[model samples]
Target chain A: MTRYLRDIFFALAALTIFVAASPVQAQSNSGPLRIEITEGVIEPLPFAIPEFIAGSSRVEDAASDITRVIAADLAGTGLFREIPRSAHISPITSFDSPVQYSDWQAINAQALITGSVSMEGGQLVVRFRLFDVFSQEPLGSGLQFVGDPDSWRRMAHNVADQVYERITGEGGYFDSRVTFVAEEGPKNARLKRIAIMDYDGANVQFLTDSRSLVLAPRFSPDGQSILYTSYETGFPQIYLMDLGTVRARVLDSQDGFMSFAPRFSPNGRSVVYSLETGGNTDIYLMDIASGRRTRLTDSPSIETAPSFSPDGSQIVFESDRSGSQQLYIMSASGGEARRISRNAGRYGTPVWSPRGDLIAFTNQQGGRFHIGVMRTDGGEERLLTSSFLDEGPTWAPNGRVIMFTRETAGADGAPAIYSVDISGRNLQRVSTPGMASDPSWSPLLQ
Target chain B: MKLFSKLIGVVALLALTACGGGGYFGDSPISGAPGGEAAGSADPNSVAYFNQTIGDRVLFVVDEHTLTSQARATLDDQADWLLRNMEFNILVEGHADEQGTREYNLALGARRAASVQTYLISRGITSGRIRTVSYGKERPIEICSAESCYSQNRRAVSVISAGPGA
Candidate 1:
């Protein structure tokens, strides 16, 4: 306990120093000039990203590319708008040069980012700092990251994560990957393969071929393994694949039953999924290590799509026991469940947000499907998007955005992945080469 | 007269190639017959006859698993055919339209297949002679978004297989 308290004291002391070092301005007597950004209409904050200084000739190309990636990452969130490079009045040629706040403020730039990249002993080093132009002070202390030259994109993502966190007070999801089902072929005979890619839809790698049908690819807590259901043996069964080795093995393939919709617990020790027995489906929890199976729900009605709360203390799922599909919450260990959705439509695919505040789901009403969210206790129901078919909502690591599948209407319509902010703003399509669906966002990358 | 002769030559060539039975086109028709049965021979006791003639599939309403009157009529023919063809067992496959969540649709398909199995049992078909599998919306015969396509996709098909005793 003494050691724990000492650690807390040291953390608090560091936080104090961090705030004291930053040059935060006091509110003027005239009015509050600084943006509070509590709620309501949001105009994107404008920022300028000058070309990073290449400390050596070897890293010149990488320096510019990394700078553009960082700018794009911030701009893509719809929270920050990047100032064009042609409009810049000041050029940063040295890593140690002081920022010309007057020039940036004249151009209406609120934030200025300056960085330098160098290659040292076959390793790449990135050093950067953010400044508040209006206050003429650095927003935070300068930071440096060292990594291999091959991992330049990851390094760029790490820098962007730090910058976003410093400004928003919430962790950024830039340094993450999404696992989804890549689909192709005609609609009647669509072939699906499991694919994984960076959060920005780069570095896509197919984990499974289209020989067998697969669904619901989920990442483990550590992002080193994946859990999906495949119909390889003419029956749907859960399989776990090691991302590092690309090897897969079936998990808990009982002779007479099918298991699917599996999700890892918060601790990553157990998996909760739905199992069908004698045509009655129920949720089950299995220990990945010991292979011990425990039934969570024994109801005759269909209960599936179970997602664990971030704390692993509770689970939110969809059930049809009340004559129609609706959202329900119950203890993680299972027993009595309370219906949370009192709306008129049918709700399914309820996934608990990583922030543990809301549950995202797919609500169908009047021949339309909507991606919606509600509080943990089912208050404040808000629909983020509506379409012919939109389902399978997966929360971003910070729970600020949701990615789901949207299929158009027609015979040739195919499923594509899309994302929307939790506030129902900034709806964007995540571009894949072809069709994709059932996206599962990994936790923030290391 | 020239077109008739050309058509006859094509049919004769097709028959010769089918008898040769080595290449892709040498095989029998893909749909009408199974197990290399003759193309024109429609044995009433054969699985193909049951599938093509008696209608091995039954459609359902949207988000419903209960058997409709028309669905029951088809199942009646299926059960009667199964009783006559005692050497063959059956597998009931349940399917759904692309209107619901994947997991829930899977469960719905299961319920649909179970409903068919129950109907077959009530018609005096032994439980041991039947099996069930639910493909949900994964295997849709029709791929459009209209009610016509959806109704066709929401179906349970009775697939026939020769039992172990056969």
Candidate 2:
């Protein structure tokens, strides 16, 4: 958070809608520039990012690196197609260069992003501008970020996020990270450890060794610590690790009970998870500061995988109360829960989207596994992926995409992380150190 | 989600200089023939004999923790063998198929192990003689994606160890 943003302009909310007159007229008689995302409504917005101009030779490497990170961030969304440099007729050779609307329009680029990187006051400084190519005007005021050299990637992410928010009206998720189980070895003897990486799968760092098995690593709301289940003592218990020291301590230890599937309350003061005592598994909530625990469910059926709503008022979770696994929602204070999964095969690993509009889950039907989403009230169910095993769905910070574990079939079957847009398109694998699973995304870094 | 629990055998393992024993102890081959034809499983009091002749594991259907009649029959023999081998301790490892979510499967496996332990206790075995641990869907004897493999995979294996004093 040491990076400083300067030249903040209180620009008027005036966005000119781009392309497709049908929705354009309906959305903007004369409103701000915007792109309303929908299924089959329009084509991908073609945009171009010529190599950001570097002010000095000292920052040449950083200039290119920042450009690559920003381009990858925007293009990876599948909403904006990056027009290759070869297709560009005009190059942003200088930060103060005048607009060449005809040159950009000739290449069919509807939007253009330009920037320059330099050093100032012993810090890496970056400046960027967004433009509506045909409109021939800057979409918003020019912005600049000043940070240490080591933080250039974050500055790039910040620039990309601003461009994204201006066009899509939604906060960007590029500046986030994901914590997951990085696995090694064969399936039967798979050694797993917790690892964290940049949102786009860059800069992976292992937090634990594979000597013990770890599963379901989740970032705390503030992104400073992680909560996961580990078999450190040959039994499953919840462990909370402070990322600063890379050390962990068990959260709640009872002699004979197994606890796992822990998730932070959005406020970060409480946690909800499943605890097994005797043969029954039930949900439990603990006040993190006081270590006071209360049972949220009391049943012979298994109830686990509790996820908090964005507002922290309610929780969505999986249970087998009806003789089969399904999803249910209950109050954050713990009371009667109502089943929300209507169409059944079997559902579990229910994760509430950060947007608070949908709950994503792993659904098993017809012997195939699926990562699907449904409205909070259990309407408009849509399956986004199908495979031999697609489990543990985690949402992107923006809630427009989900990442989950997709393991192939057979003796050598291994798990890898994959993500898909909520529209059931743009499915792709997220690279990790080795095999990985159970990804939980962190909120945008402060 | 859960893993190997050697809690009941700490003392036994400590005394043996810790070989950790093969997890495949239940599937040992009958190595010899008539009288002493097979050096393995020849002595009734031997660990191999208990595993090969008395049976060491029972399979369950998908998502079900309840023991079937055949599973109960195998437990009966297992309980009888345990009574004869009074100096031995048992670890019941429950496993599940890969068809369910990780946490759900872990809990299911725990229930299966508990069911077997409760049944053994009903047959006069002390709770101290048996400890239960769920491998969940982590350890599978067979790895095929088909039901043939999954059926055998959903199993509870009674692993025996000589007690600390032995």
Clashing pairs in 1: none
Q: Deviation in angstroms for A45 in model 1?
A: 0.5
* Model 1 lDDT tens row, B1-166: 3553354345434443332211211111222122223442387775556656766788899889999998898889889988987876776777899999999998888888889999999998999887776777887767789988999888877766557556
Off by over 4 Å in 1: A1-41, B1-41
Cα lDDT tens digits, model 1, A1-446, are 23212211221111112332444453121112233323632898899999999988889999999998899888888888999999999899897777888999999998888998998777788888878778777766677777766667777887788777777767789888899999998886678999988788877778899988889999998887889998776567899887876789988789657788999999999999999876889999999988999999998899999999999999999999999999999999999999999886999999999989999999999999999999998999999899999999998898988999999989789899998888888889998988999999999865
TM-score of each: 0.88, 0.89
Ten-residue region with minimum lDDT total, candidate 2 chain A: A1-10
Docking class of 2: acceptable
Candidate 1's TM-score reads 0.88
Per DockQ, the best of the predicted structures is: 2
- Per-candidate Cα lDDT values, in order, are 0.81, 0.80
